[model samples]
Target: MDLHLKGKNAVILGGTRGIGRAIAETLAGEGANVAVCARNAGQVAETVEALQSRGVKSTGASVDITDADALKSWIRKAGVELGGIDILVSNAGAMAQGNTPEAWTQNFQLDVLGAVNAFNAAEPFLDKAAKSHGDAAFVIIASVSAAQADRADSYGPVKASLIHFAKGLARENAAKRLRVNVVSPGMVYFEGGIWHMIETNQPEFFKQANSRNPTGRCATPQEIANAAVFLASPASSYTTGVNLIVDGAVSNRVNF
Candidate 1:
């Protein structure tokens, strides 16, 4: 499928590894120039090199998303270097799972405010792209846990906030031709990802979680990335203000 992403410029937060890396690679594969940022300098460099090797203009910075000033600066610099930002993927998250105050603060700072700051910093560039190209997109990588409550966890509520914020942003930006959407992935398993840790340390729990899925497995990072990149591409021009779940039917609640 031609995503019509050639020549487009995209910025992805937390793009060094796991799901974020998958999204960055997918976008670059579709010919979008990409700028990525993460806290690990080595991983950032490696991911940037990988993207560039795919024949797309790619740049990356090592910056903590929780540092709002640094994050905004990186976004602006990326726009300048990449020429402009047509797509912004807010994929960073603290993944804080507890109900502790510290966990709540961490999730809020990284997951919620991170997206807020990135969008604010990228808005002007996105507006410009929309004006020139007739379309621009912001894709937030949320989690299916947002709509499910197996326990009291900070992560789920923080993710839910993101979905609410995305819908509101989508409506507000519609007139400007800038689309906003959320991709809520469920139990995406990768070597170094959260599910992998569960699979290793809590084998029985991981097995149960895997069995909960009718597919008898969790999603792959690339599967989630495919949905994210598609939502950010012009191919999904009419798709906005929607929470697209890529959960392999692990989630039983009807979206409606």
Candidate 2:
């Protein structure tokens, strides 16, 4: 309940909107300092201001996560500015679909490399925080699509790679008290997100998508964020190298 997160600092990628923004706000509300980064300078600024309004020290930067050097630099700077990164959330994704080479490139660069660079840059800060507090975490936002795919696409494979990466990190960093985990969301919908656009332009497909969910609906950004923030919190100290699926049972694959 308490989460014991007060005074901790967190760095979030793509925290300007959607599920990323919700995670930032949730951490801020839990009394954790937050730093977010995204390509939109205006949105980054707005999110920073909004997080600070929640009475937590907050900062943000405009960053293109596809650029490994730039993403790593921002993450390092954010770790310092936040006073040490106790939690790192990789919530950014290209969301590129299809089997085209370009789609694969985009997903690999943004979704895959983005998490790799962020973790590499934040490892030192994360190790330091864990050494001092006995708990530090990296939460990767993946998708249930990673577990099952109906067709060839870049999105699912890239997300699946992240799970593998996080598991390796978790095992290697366990001695450092740095826990790594994944929160895989299914069909999360938010205004201006992909689902919203689909609802507007491809009404029948959107309706069919909703109907596919056993709950007869999709998840909210906040719903996914709740799982992410929980994993990032000290309360889940023993929950490393695990993928928590928050899909309202939309996904049929059993974890067994």
Predicted candidate 2 versus true structure: per-residue lDDT over 1-256, tens digit per residue: 8999999999999998999999999999999999999999999999999999999999999999988899888888888788999999999999998999999999999988889989999999999999999999999999998999789998999999999999999999998899999999998889999999999999999999999899999899999999999999999998899999999998888797
TM-score, candidate 1, is: 0.99
Which pairs clash inside model 1?
Answer: none
The lDDT of each candidate is 0.95, 0.94
lDDT of 1 by residue, 169-194 (tens): 99999998999999999988899999
Error of 1 at 4 (Å): 0.2
Mark the 10 consecutive residues where model 1 has the least summed lDDT: 247-256
TM-score of each: 0.99, 0.99
Superposed by TM-score, candidate 1 places the C-alpha of residue 110 at a distance from the truth, in angstroms, of: 0.1
